[model samples]
Target: MSETNGAWTWRLEDTSGTVVPVSEEYADQHFASQGDAESWVGEFWRELAEQGVVAVTLFELDRQVYGPMRLDTN
Candidate 1:
């Protein structure tokens, strides 16, 4: 999903490769650019871990930019 025209989305995911439900708590997961998405994950991954997000992924349309990056160290 597009955050805005010419922008990207920071999608939160579960271990099953399903998109996590978007909530008021995570309203900003979609970002203005890839860098912004990465930055959001970088800053809040620990919080995401607590919320049961095992991995994260990025996309522009059906194209995956990157991810499935793990939040848990173990």
Candidate 2:
């Protein structure tokens, strides 16, 4: 998918590829840039893991750019 001009967002999910429901505070995070989206996840991935988010998928608008990236830093 094209990586430019579209909104960047994350699809939080568990290992089963099921979407995980995070708290409202993090439920609506959308970014104008991919770096921002990556950075946000980098910062909060620990917390997300604690809350059962085992993986994440990146999307640009409705098009998935990449992922199902595991949050495990091991």
TM-score of each: 0.75, 0.88
What is the per-residue lDDT of model 2 for residues 1-64, given as tens digits with 9 covering 90 to 100?
A: 2334549989999989999998877776888898989988999999998888999999988999
Give per-candidate clash totals.
0, 0
* Best candidate (score: TM-score): 2
Error of 1 at 39 (Å): 0.6
Question: Among these predicted structures, which one has the highest lDDT?
Answer: 2
Model 1, stretches more than 4 Å misplaced? Answer: 1-6
Give candidate 1's TM-score. 0.75
lDDT of 1 by residue, 1-74 (tens): 33545456666889997877655566444566777777777887887877777898778756888887877888
Provide the global lDDT of candidate 2 against the true structure: 0.86
Deviation of model 2 at 36, angstroms? 0.5
